[model samples]
Target: MLCVTDRMKLIHTKGTQGIRGHTILFVVIGLLITETSTQAANSTDEELLNLKLRLNTWKNRYRVLCNKYSELAANSSAPVINCTGCPDGWFQVGDQCFLLTRDVRVDWQASKKKCAEIGSHLAILTSKEQHEALENERMRTRVAYTDFWIGLTDVENEGDWKWVDNSMLKTPFWNTLKSEPDNNQSGGEEGEDCAVVDSKSQSWYDVPCSFLYHRVCQMDAIPLQ
Candidate 1:
């Protein structure tokens, strides 16, 4: 019933309306995506801020505790070295702190005395784990085939080894390869009375107490409250 030109105009109008509807739908979807991204970014910023605040709070608390400990230590006669953990330059293993000194080499007796002066004792390797820790530390120093004195000696009675702590040696972890503790008395030595740990093999060997070597020191870790 309509003329050709009118029919064409009606078709064009419908097409325009359809295109406008699609544009509106796309704009709505884009706005939703942008809003969601903004919200997520805001949430992430809040979480990061909270984490930073907590870290700062903990650091402040640690500083206060350190100051308190220092004051207490100054007043006490036998100053309790209650570290929050191991003191600086000391490594913590289990409940013990260990320090290996590579600079100063001294005889067994002198080494033991030095440790006492520092409120520690020559290292006592009571277990394989303790031995391993010392071994690992030695490796870290990159000192190859070096000997380090431990807190073991049979000076009181030959063949009756004991720890400096006065504990009788139970199960020995000696390196039998070179027939160690042979008491070889080589080079006119009296006897091999003191024990030294070999860096390479991580094994124990007895050398003359007068022999100079590096030393390892051990102390009890600070108790946690």
Candidate 2:
């Protein structure tokens, strides 16, 4: 069995193969180095404060990655470099794992929290492939819910959407026909700050964060040797 330190080292030495693979190295290195530097006695107050802020960012990344690692590992596949597939109950699309909830409806924030409770977060679709994969998955599953909460939201500043990872929204697939994400005031007092994918139309639309809906949770699929 590979130890945590050894696994970290192995990841560094081999490096992740793709764009997202390097994410672990970047976050882990920043987290470890910033943590060490923060302990230095000669650091200025401003420097310490900056380090703490960066550390917090890195820590968030670490938490997201760690959640994926734990979930994938929990599936009990024989330890190997190449991953066989996503764990039970999670379907794989590219290098990520996703879970579509059923018989459970909750508000956007509650859905996000529930995903975290299970070591995941609301789905963040960054690519057309991911979007199509999820659409097909929804069709195949035949769920009753048409709208499912995703990770995209403009809660921090309405109309300026971002994912759970704080990344700016790119390659969006909003339902243009509906003129969605208008932050429609009719939705609620705070307006529609959260996004949900319409399973039938295969498009996303902004909705009130307080509205109850099913959710699609996602996490990275990290394979360990």
lDDT of 2 by residue, 1-225 (tens): 999999998887776455466787799999998887886644677788999999779766766665676777778783523343466778888678999898579999899899999899999987777777777787788865678899999999877999999999988889999888789989769899999998677789998899999999999884532
Clashes of 2: 0
Local accuracy of candidate 1 as per-residue lDDT tens digits, 1-225: 889999999999999999999999999999999999999999999999999999779867886786688778788875555444577778878779998886768899999999999999998887888878877876776656467889999989989999999999887788988887788688245778999987567789988888898898999986544
The regions of model 2 sitting more than 4 angstroms off are: 1-84
Overall local distance difference test of candidate 1: 0.84
Error of 1 at 9 (Å): 88
Candidate 2 whole-model C-alpha lDDT, 0 to 1:
0.83
TM for candidate 2 is 0.61
* lDDT for each candidate structure: 0.84, 0.83
